[model samples]
Target chain A: MKMSGAQMICEAIIAEGIKTVFGYPGGAIMNVYDEIYKQNKFEHILTRHEQAAVHAADGYARASGEVGVAMVTSGPGFTNAVTGIATAYTDSIPLVVISGQVPLSLIGTDGFQEIDAVGISRSCTKHNYLVRTLEELPRVLKEAFYIARSGRPGPVLVDVPKDITGEIGEFFYPSEVNLPSYKPNYKGNNRQIHKAAKAILEAKKPLLYIGGGAVLSGAAEIVRELAWMTQIPAVETLMSRGVMGAKNPLLLGMLGMHGNYASNMAMSETDLVISLGARFDDRVTGKLSEFAKYADVIHVDIDPANIAKLVDVDYPIVGDIKTVVEKLIPLLKEEIRTERYQVWRDILGRYDELHPLLYNDSDEVIKPQWAIERLGELVGEQAIITSDVGQHQMWAAQFYPFDRPNQWINSGGLGTMGFGFPAAIGAKKAVPEKTVINITGDGSILMNVQELVTAAEHRIPVINVILNNHFLGMVRQWQTFFYDKRYSETDLSYQPNWKMLAEACGGIGYDVTTKEEFDAAIKDAIAQDKVAFVNVAIARLENVLPMVPSGGALYNMLLEHKEEK
Target chain B: MEAVRRVISVVVLNEAQVLARVSGLFAARGYNIESLTVAPIPETDMSRITIVTKGNKRVIEQITKQLHKLIPTFKVIEHEEMVEKELALIKFPIEESLSDIQVLCQAYNGGIANVGEKMVIGMVTDEPARVKHFIEAAKRYSPIEIVRGGVVAIER
Candidate 1:
C-alpha cells in the first residue's frame, strides 16, 4: 500500500509489535504526529517534555525487552532526548529513537527549528540513519530496530525530514537485516574456550566476575552452575545485581568502587579471574594495573571489542556469555574441592560480619536505607526494584538483596539522574504480574517526573518511592566532604509538593515523614491499583558510605559517619 | 608493569578533513589510540587509517564505541580478528642475489605479492603482527623503496 513516510514509520513500529510510543509533537515532527493521530493501532503518549517521552519509552523497552520507541522533533526536542538516549546506550538497553528533521533543502542553512540531530546523537547511539527518501523509510526502520536489539543492545536513531515524511512510498518491513558490517560474533572460538577452561581448572583461587550482560544474555543460571561446579565464588557488577540470588552461599555481592569489601577483596586476591559479560570499568578496577594483579584473567563478552579493553586477559573468549559458559562447563572436571571455596567464604564472612551496614538514630524522618531494607523485606525476592541516581540509589543497591536475574534496573554507566521513573514503568509493563517499585531521590524524580502521565495513561501501576531529601544528596555529600560544607547549588529549595504533582498527573500520591508513615504509604500505594508515588521526607545531610574517592584505590574508601571531632 | 600496544587500521572517507573528526572521536572519548596513519585509497576518495592503541577487550570496544556513529563512517572492522595484509617495497643492495631474497620473500608471501626494480618490492598479507614481523625480517635485506600500505581487514 502506498503511504507517506510518516505513516510508513508508524506502520513499521506496528509491524515490529509496538503497541505504544511516548513522544511530544513539535514543528518538524508535526507530520509524524498527524500520521499517529490517524492510526488507532498504536497508542501515542503525549508527554510534558521530550526528555520524559524518551525516558518513558526507555522504561518501556527495559521492561518489555522489546525496542522502546520514542518520537521527537528537531532542535530542542531532539536535544532533550540526548540524555535518555545516552542512558540507554550506556546500559545497553534496546531503544528506537525517531526524531523529525527540517527539510533536506533547509539542512545546514540555519533553517527554523533545525539542528544536526545525527551529528549531536552520534556518540550516543548504536547506529543512526537520516532518511532522505520515502522509499528508504521501511529499510531505515528495519535496520534501526535490528541494530537497537542486536549484539549488546543499544539505542538506534532514524531522523526523518519533515518534507520526506509527506512524500509517498510503498512500505514493506523486511523480515531480515543484511548489513554486512553489522555481523556480531556470537560463538567463542574453540581454542579460546579450551584455554579459558584450562585456566579456570589450573588456578588455586578462581573468581567468576559477572555483569549485566549475564542477564541480557540469559546466562544467570549458567553462571551460578559454573560457580557451583568450579568451586569459584562469584562477584556481580551493579548491572548484574540480580543475576544470582543474593542468598546463595557462593554469591560474593557486587564488586566495584561502591561494592562490598568482600567482593573487592576477592577480586584483588583471586589467582584466576573469569569475567563473563562484564566490562572492566574504572569504577570496578580503581587502578587498572592494580586490579586483579595476581590473576590470569579469562574475559568473555559478546562484544569482541570489549575482550582486552581494560584489564589484560590471558585468554579472551568473544561470544555470548551464556554460550561461552555453557561450552566451558562440560570441558572442566567437576571434582568438588571445598578448600578454596571455604577460604574465600571465611574471608568474605569475616568482612561481612565486621563492617555490616548500620544506621543509628531515632530521628523523626525515616532513614532512606531502612526504608529500602524494609521494602526488600516486605516484597521479598520477587519484586523488581529500579532506582534513579543519588544517595537513595546507592542505599537501594546496598540494602536490597535481589534473588533473581533482570531485577534491580538502574542507570549504572551513564549515571543518568532521572532514569528510575521510566525504567520502573518499563519493568512493570514487561512483567505486569510482578510488583515494580522506583526508588528515586527528590532531585532525580523531578528530572523525569512527567512520566507519571504516561504511567497513568497506560494504567501501569508502578509504585514510585521518592526519598525526598530536598537536595541532590550525592552532590551535597560531596560538597560537605570536599567543599567544607558550603552547600553550593546542590540544595533544591523551591520544590513542588509531590502529592499535588502526582494528583495533577492523575495518579495517587502520599506524603510520609516517619517509618510508620512510610510503611502505611507503601501499603496504600500498593493497594491503589494505579500509578502511585509515596514521597518520604528523608534526612537531607545523608551520604552514601564506603565511597571510593575518584582515582583512589578500592581499599581506600571513606566510611560514612566516621569518628571525628 | 609496562603497557602493551596494538596497531589498528580504520578505513574511512577521504573528504574535507575527516582525519580530524576521526582523531577527535578518539580524543573526546579519552581513548588513547596511538600512532594513527591516514591516506587516501589509490583510486577512490576513501582513506584508510591505521591506529596503534593499547587495551584489552573492554578497552578496544570502548575505543570503537562511537565509530559507527560518524556519518562518513561506512564501516569499522578490527583487523586483529580478521585476515589482513600490508605491502612494503624496500631498495636493497644490487649485489644481493634475487633468488636468495625471492626464497625469503616467498616464505613471507612477499615474493609474488609485489615485485620492482633496484627495489625488490615484497608484499606480505598476513595478520598485523605477522605483517610487522615480516617488515622486520625484510629490514635485514636493505634496499631503498620502503613504503608500507595501510592495513585492510576481511573476516574469515
Candidate 2:
C-alpha cells in the first residue's frame, strides 16, 4: 500500500507495539505531528521541554522493560535532548529517539534549525541513522528499535529530514531484521558455566556482585535463585537496587561509595567475586589496585568489552545474565555449602552489627533520613520510587525497603539532577496502577520543576517529595568534610515557595517543617488524584555517610562525620 | 606485561559517519590508534578498516571487543599469524641520482613512478618493518619529502 512518509512512521511505530510517545513538536516535524493528529494508532504526549520528553521515555523503558520512544524537532530541540540521551546511554536503557532534521537540500548548508545531530550523538548513542530517502525510513525505524532493545541495551537515535516525512512511498515493515553483524550472544559456554559453578562451591568466601544488567536482562529472579541455592551473600550496585530485595538475609545492601559497611568489607575480604551483569565502574571499584585483591573475579556480561575494561577478569563469560545464571543454577544445586562460608558470614555479621545504617534522630527538626524512612514505611513496596541525584537520592537508597525488581529507579551513572520528576511521570504512565513518587532534593527538584505542569496537564498524579535542605546537600557535605566549610556557591538559600509553585501549576502542595507535618502531607498527597508536591524542610548540611573518599579503598569508609578543627 | 604493538582489521558497512564512530570510540576511551587506514571493499557495500595500535594484552582485547560492538562492524580481525604490508612514496630532488634511488626502492620492492623537472617520485611496497628500514636508508639520498601509508594486514 502507498502512504506518506509520515503515515509510514506512524504505521511502523504501531507495528512495533508502541502505544505512547513523548515529544515537543516544532516546524521541522510539523508533518509528522499532522499525521499524528490524524491517526489514533498511538498517543503522543506533549512534554514541556525536549529533555523531559526524552527522560520520560527513558524512565518508561527502564521501568517496563520495553523500548521507550520519544520524538523532537531539529536544532535546539535535539541539543536539549542530548543530556537525557546521555543519561539513558550511561545506564544502558532501551530507548528510541526520533529527531527531525532540516530537509535534505538544506543539510550542511547551515539551514535554520539545522544541526549535526547524528554527528553529535555518535559517541553517546549505541547506534544512529540519518534517513536520506523515504524508502529507508521503514528499515531505519525497524532497526532503531532492534538495536535499542538488544544486547546490552542503549538509546538509539533516528534523524529524519523534513522532506522525507512528506515524500510518498510504498510502506513495508520488515518482520525480522537480518543484520549479521548485530547478533547478541544469549547463551553462555557450558564449560565456562561449569567452571564458575565449581569455583562457587569450592570458595570459602564468595560474594555475588549484581548490577543493572541483571535488571535489564530480567535475570533478577534467577540471580536471587543462584544466591539462595548456593547459600552465598549478594551485594547490589546503585543501579541494581531491589534485585535481592530489602529483607533477604543474604543480601548485603548496596556496595560502593555510600554503600553499607558490611557490604564494602565483604567485597574487600571475599575470596571469589561472581560478577553478574555488572561493570566494575570506578565509583564501585575505588582504588582498583586494592579492590577485590584477594578474589578471583568471574564476570558474566553480554558486552564482552566491559568484562576487563577496568579490572582483570579471571573467568570471562560473555552472554545474557539470565541465560548464564540459569546454566549455573543446576550445577550449583549439586553442592550446597552452607557451613563452609560460616566464618565469612560471621565476620560480615559482626561488621553489620558494628555499624548499622543509622542517623541522629532530631525531634526539634526533620532529619532527611527519617523522612525517607517514614515515606518508605507508609508506601512500603507499593509505590514505584524515582529520585534525582543528590544527598536525597542516597538517603532514599539507604533507607527505603525495596523488595521488588524495578521498584527503585534513579539516575545512577549519569547522576543527572533534573531526571526524577519527569522520570516519575514516565514511570506512572508505564504502570498506571502503581503509585509513582519522585524523591528529590531541593536543589535537584527545581531543575525539572516545570514538569509539575506536565504532570498536571497530563493528570499523571505522580507525587514529588522534595527534601528541602536549602542547599546542594552533597556538595555542602563535601565542603564541610574536606574543605574549610567555605560554602562557596553550594548554598541555595533563595528558594521559591514550592506550595505556590505547585498551586500555580494546577496541583496540590504542602510545606512541612516537622515530622508530624511530613507524615500528614505525604498521606494527603498520596490520596490526592492530581500531581502533588510535599516539600519537607530537612536539616541542612547533612551528608551521605560511609563515604569511600573518592579513590580510597572500599573498606576505608568513614562511618561518621567528625568536626574538623 | 608491557605494551606491545598490534594490528587490528575491522570489516564494516560502508556508510557516512562510520569512520567517525570507529575513531570516536578510540578517542573517548583514550585508546591509542598509531595508524589507521580505511578503504571500500571491492564490489561490496562494505569497508575495511586497518588500525595499528599499541597496548598490552588486556587493552588489545578490550579494543577488539569494543570494535565488535559497533553496529556496522561485520568482523574484527586480530590475529598473531598475519601478513602486513605498507607503502611509501618519497620525492627526491632531481639532482640526486635516479639509479641510486631506484636501487634503494628495489631493495624495498618498488621503483620510480615519475621523474619530473624538479623531483623524482619513488614508490615502494613492502612489510611495514622493511618499509621503515627503506625510509631510513633513503634519508641518505636527501629526499625532498616522504609520505607513508598506514599498514594493512591479513591473516596468513
Candidate 1's displacement at residue A508, Å, is: 2.5
Candidate with the greatest TM-score versus the true structure: 2
Q: Write the per-residue lDDT of candidate 1 for residues A1-565, one digit (tens) a residue.
A: 8888888888898999998788889999998988899889988777677777777787777666688999999999999999989988898988999999999899889998888887777678876777877777898799899888878899988898999998887878889987654667788899999888777667777888998899888888988888877778888988888787878888878877777777887788889888988998987888776788888989998776676766677898878988888989888856446474677668767876776656655466677878888898888676888999988888888779888877778899999988888878767766788889999988999888878888898888889999888888888888888889888888887789889899898899999988888878888888888899898887767677777776776666676664322
DockQ score for model 2:
0.84
Model 1 over residues B1-156: C-alpha lDDT tens digits?
A: 344565566667675436766787787677776466677779976787777677765656666655654545657666556555565555566556777677766777667444445445555555556666767776677756566665554556
The TM-score that candidate 1 achieves is 0.83
- A413: Cα error in model 1, Å: 1.0
Model 2 segments more than 4 A misplaced = A562-565
TM-score of each: 0.83, 0.98
Per-residue lDDT of candidate 2, residues B1-156 (tens digit)? 699999999999998888998999999989999899999999999999999999999889989999999999999999689989999999999999999999989988999989999999999999988999998999988988999999999999
C-alpha DockQ of every model: 0.14, 0.84
